[model samples]
Target chain A: MKYSGWNILKQALTGKKEWAPVWHKPEPKSHYETIVIGGGGHGLATAYYLTTEYGMKNIAVLEKSHLGSGNVGRNTTIIRSNYLLPGNEPFYELSMKLWENLEQTLNYNAMVSQRGVVNLFHSDAQRDSFVRRGNAMCIAGADAVLLDERGIRNLCPFLDYENSRFPIKGGLLQPRGGTVRHDAVAWGYARGSDSLGVDIIENCEVTGFIIKEGRCVGVETARGNISANKIAVCVAGSSGRLMGKAGIRLPIESHVLQAFVSEGLKPILPNVITFGAGHFYISQSDKGGLVFGGDIDGYNTYAQRGNLPIVEDVCAAGVAIMPMIGRSRLLRMWGGLVDMSMDGSPFIDKTRIEGLYFNGGWCYGGFKATPASGFCYAHLLAKDEPHPVAAEFRLDRFKRGHMIDEKGAGAQPNLH
Target chain B: MIINHPLLGPRDASEFIYLGDASLIDRPDWNSENAAQQFYEYLYLRDNPAGTIRELWFHEYGDRSWLVVTRNTLTHEIVNVELARDIDREEKHSR
Candidate 1:
């Protein structure tokens, strides 16, 4: 059912009784052309694009749990394409463009707010580094503005500008970057894909892959065995475990990254502000809650939870940059398992196993790359070739010593 | 989480830097024919189990000791902690 103003009005006139489900819940079939594992934003978007863009309608997405139960819903909801690396800038810029037209494309109110993102810099060295990053963003055709201390003060007056230890020097701003309603993207993509005849199977945990000879032809799930011409795995942090069942050890580590939201208050934050000396990044939600997150828990684990020390560390970072955050009581905090790659980037390429495609290693930065990752994964699945923008995201890049170290954090997974 | 160190009584887990699986300490021989492949697997691949796991943790804050902490990943419970240098010495002697 295509939603419109007139449809809503008609439904309202009829006592709002004829409202349909957002997406159809279909029973799993024995066979399909392609099977997408994980029904998060990336999986749903991949399914949506496979049907819409590639005309491959005989697709099914297998989610282990209810939709949006993963990192898609447990993120800070910020989006930006202000990257510095050549292997990353163009790809994120494409994602930024896709984000610009996402609402119109899906005909869904995703609330794609373009309130801008400002990365605060504390020291001269950090400012110089941001200057380079801003120039790189401009080179990649993305908007970037280098803000001085005065400009930052004007933008966010509440920020701690004069902390003696970590004084705020300036900031690098991306004017077109902002936040989106995280779950809405998943819902819209699921609805659009369902409308295009893609089966979205929920609560069906994949136990193992069906390997015939040397190719992965299907999957063994809790429901039953389902065959497919192509099996695409995109289960974020669970990538290592899922791929391990096929005797394929992934170059990914699962880390629990926690996100927090404070009690609703009067809207104060105008733009997304990231702490220069620390890992804290926060933005006020439309509901007036301050949504924020810091670094991932520095350990490799599959559990969707975190420890108290990291909580203390994150709150400390928050208080360090914005002293007012201490007054806002934290209403809720949740953790999401993130697939931290060796080089702090993501992978969107085919694996060695024939008919078995892989799309993960997103670390904690997967939410912002959802659309582009899905589009590129769909393109790869349909055409058996990586998309031009995603050509650098090869799974074998580590073997070839071509790692896309965006943060230049070397080979450390947690640091990334 | 608190790791009861062998020498330094007990220390908060935050004071230690988490490396990863204890299998990382068993570094493959560099002179092997498939050293590149072995290094790739050693550096990237990990057995991230849902149950008990032995991981490497360095107490950078307290006694500067690299420890092998056997903990349950599901429950985040520290079951055992030992000096990694002792493990290295034992392995070398056994070899």
Candidate 2:
């Protein structure tokens, strides 16, 4: 039952009962060629690419909870490739390219709106840094534009320009960056993979890994024991705990990051805008609610909730830039657990145990890196080699003194 | 969240700056034979448990004392607080 305009019209003209479920609830098999843990966006995307790109078969995705129950559905839905480091710029640019063709590729509506993303800079030094970052983006074949104060004002006139503390300066604009329907991405990939004969088993929690000698032979789950030649762990916040079951500690810490949405109003923000002096970033959703978030709670926690101080701090930062948002009635807020790595950058690499792979430590930026993370993880599983764009994202980078500390926050997961 | 500071009784958690895992207090000897591996583990690896854990917090806005705060990561409940200097001295005596 391929989704198409003709099919939709035919179903509409008929009794509208011809529609099928988005994905099948398939029971887990005893064995599979590869087992992908965590049925979040990355896991599903990895399975999707493994089947579609590598022509692989007998793949199963195991989820502890239902699909889109993790950060994939919890993110602010913004996507961009405005990175500053060489190790990251090209990979995110590849993700940006993938997002451009995602809907057509999956035959599902993902609502990838590239309205643009503007990273605001409040001072002279910040402007210079943004310029350097824009140059880095351009060098990586990603679109970037350095917009002056006038340009930012033209895009968002409601910004506080005359504030005595941190006045508006300029911003680095990426015209090809914006928001996507977050949950739809998971559904699209899930459906696309399931339609291609991949089993997606939900509510099956992986309790441990079965290691035969030095190789990972299978996984012990709450449902039962399942075997696979290769097992890939893509649980974002649960990376540390999941891998810990195999007696392998990770260079990752789980932190709670909260996101907020205000009462629906008329459209005000044209694109994603990030505050320079603070960790605040905001964009208006299609429903006219302002979707925004700030820094993580700055502690190690698996709890998917935050305290009041961060909420107040994020709200203050929001008011510092766009004062009008202060008047908007607060609607709802929620937290998502994020895997903050030592060097801040993510890892898409294999582990010491043969045939066991790991993909996590996305910090707070995993949502934007979903496509590339999946594509690269699939490439690794299929070819047993890192993708060229993700070659630097090795598990032993820290041990080899090759830390990709993008924010220069050394060995501190919370700061990153 | 409130941190029951060892020195100052019951203070807002915001007054303190959180540094991760209290195990960081046990710095490995650099001159050991397995210095490289030990340093790697010290810098990268983490228990990151979902249950009760001890972590370091600096009283930045209040006193200049460093405290080892034992808190449950799952519930964010502070169980105990002690001066890091006291803990360091106790460990030294044990050694």
Candidate 3:
């Protein structure tokens, strides 16, 4: 296997082996260290990092539903740092690094395949955008190679070369990015963090917060109340509804994102291919089946399942773009609710509320940022200081007008 | 191969997301407003009763791009669904 910078960076991060005091009975134990809400990959990874990297094991991860049942498990499992924003690029690159060595760090097989992903540019403007993004990634010491038709064809042969409106020009290939088993990742972090003594409270929903003297004293879960000195909200889909209860108005929209799978076939797609023009993305799984997803449902909906139009739409794009795939029949489809932020970027910064931190609004790219988000958020929560990786996601940026809106299309995908 | 989606209207005028073999017309920086009309006319805009409407025309104002539509060749009926835009567009002719 060819080693990339992603492999080098993955060697840098570490996880904890210690655990915080568990609270089986709901009650404030004097002043526990930290309380992380939303026990998905973000929450679990945050706990593991805080305990390992920060030596702060006095932490608890509270999950409303079962772990890995949220957006973390709902993602298509693509991990790449091919971002265009200056502020956002390095952070996701850091995420890419962490993903490179995730198997060893977690001591679990995440099934991470760095088969490579190419963002095809069909126009001059698109090429220009790729140039800027590639330069940025290169500056950050990440791989972002520009490939021509020959290169693209060598990567994916079954694509249609003729009879298409937008003929192929070239693409941006990020060798560091690829795919992973989404659910196994969540479980690996949970098992790793649990071994370290971090409490993984499943089916424990945070109904509200206990605030005294303008500071969050504890959380009110379905089981009851528990006190902590600090708290972090890492939930994605239900982030809005959860924050609303605390009177916190976040610029987050609950958007439904979905994915589809084709019945098992002799593997054809070699790597992940994303269309820069339309909301099209696809990759062949190890099971010899095609797995893919696209733009989030623009509407705000709690519906775990979407309508029939999108399934047909995504598969249509798949078949239209690649003629060889026309015969592959779609097998199953699913939905995931994501916290679509106003800037199309995440908010991994301290909130206005005292002792409150947030790690959400990852949009469609959260899975790619799993390790980086966890490591950075752990640094912030444990030391009460922001890490370099997540400094760009500061809440003040929104206030300071220095927001890192890479798409320049604002928050909406239709607009972006 | 020909089917009508409930959400997407029948044939040309109907705004449906296409989950079939189609491509975006190669145009330089076409505005979103014109891109929709141009894309429809280029790949999807067709007769009252035609073959499977392989290309898409999603009404982005609502439900966003998850909607997919196709027209039946014989009955002129429409078949549509909310699909993940997992399809890859043929970029060779897209520009």
Candidate 4:
């Protein structure tokens, strides 16, 4: 049923029993035209686009667990297009545009709040770098503004401007960037795809892939062997392991990134603020809790947890930037596995196998790139060619010495 | 987390810097016929297994020595620790 205000009023006036479940639990079929692995935000979005835009049929999304159990639900929910590189700016800008019309398109309230995002600058060099980034954002048709110290103070007066080390300088502001309800994105996409005759099978883990000759055929799952004409793997952190089952080694590593939330209090932060000298970024949630995160734990691990050093380091950076939140008691913290690619950029391309495709290596920035990532993956699956914006995100870019390393941090995944 | 450094006994894991898979010690031969492919695999691909694996760690804040730490990626359990130079010499002798 369409979720309209009139429908809500009728349901309220009635016994409220006419409502239906958002999505149905459908059993997996023996064969499908396309199979999308990992029913996270990207996979669901891919299925949604494949059905709605491309008019494809017989698509099934297989999830190891329930939907939104991965990085899609684990992110800090901030979205922005304040990128510096040409290879990254346009693609993220496309995603920003998609986020603007997401709720209306899906007929769901995603809570996409464009409260703006400010990347703080601590030094003159940092300010120059931010200026360059703002120019890039503007060139890519995204909004960007370079705010001075006075401007930043006017926006957030609680910042520690007089700190002896790394004092406040300026920031690059993107007025069209802010937060969204993270898990709701997954639910909205799943419901929309399910309504369009796409089967979403949860708790069905894909154990391996079936290869015949040089072409991909199907997948071997915990439930049963299912065949598909095309199989697209969109598992974020499990990319390395899942592709390894097909004997395809990826240029990706799985690392744990931790996020923290403080006890609920009166809302203070007006926008998402990122620390310049450190890896800390924070924004206040609608629930009045401060949502923040920092650098990933510098190690290779599939375990969905991090060590204490990173937590302490992130808290220290938080205090160094905004001294006002020093007393807010830490409420909860959790970790999510991130597919850190070698060049720190993502890949949305096909593999050497004929019918197999891969879409992962999102690092810690997968949440914001959900819409574009799905749309591009669907474009690739439907037309057998990459979308214009994601043409550079090829699997062979690293092998061809065409790495899109945004940080220029070389092949070190942890540093990126 | 604590790293049982081979020389420094037990120490906080923060005192060391992680450099990823120990297979990095076997840098591909640049003059080989398949240099490009070998270099690509060496620089990018990793056997990021869920179980036990060998990795390189530098004692940056403790001692100026590199250690090859074998640990389980699933449980973060340290299995063994040895000086990287010793492991390098042993591998060279075996090779």
* 3 or 4, greater by TM-score: 4
Model 3 error, position A119 (Å) = 0.8
Instruction: Give each model a TM-score.
Output: 0.98, 0.99, 0.77, 0.99
Q: Which pairs of residues collide in model 4?
A: none
> Which candidate number maximizes DockQ?
2
lDDT-superior candidate, 1 or 4: 4
Model 1, C-alpha of B43: deviation from truth (Å): 1.7
lDDT of 1: 0.91
Q: Candidate 4's residue-wise lDDT over A287-362, tens digit each?
A: 9999999999989898899999999999999999999899999999999999999989999999999999999999
CAPRI tier of model 1: medium
TM-score of chain B of each: 0.96, 0.97, 0.34, 0.96
| lDDT (10s digit) by residue, model 2, range A278-387 | 99999999999999999999999988999999999999999999999989987999999999999999999999999999999999999889999999999999999999
Q: lDDT tens digits, residues A119-225, model 3?
A: 98787888888898899999987899999888988887777656367777789999878999988888878878877778777888899988777787788888778
What interface RMSD do all candidates show, one decimal each?
1.3, 0.8, 16.3, 0.9
C-alpha RMSD in Å of predicted model 3 compared with the true structure: 12.9
lDDT of 1 by residue, A191-266 (tens): 8888889999999999999998989999999999999999999899899889989888777888899999999989
Question: TM-score (0 to 1) for chain A, all models?
Answer: 0.98, 0.99, 0.91, 0.99
RMSD values for the candidates in order, in angstroms, are: 1.2, 0.8, 12.9, 0.8
**Candidate 3 chain A lowest-lDDT run of ten:** A16-25
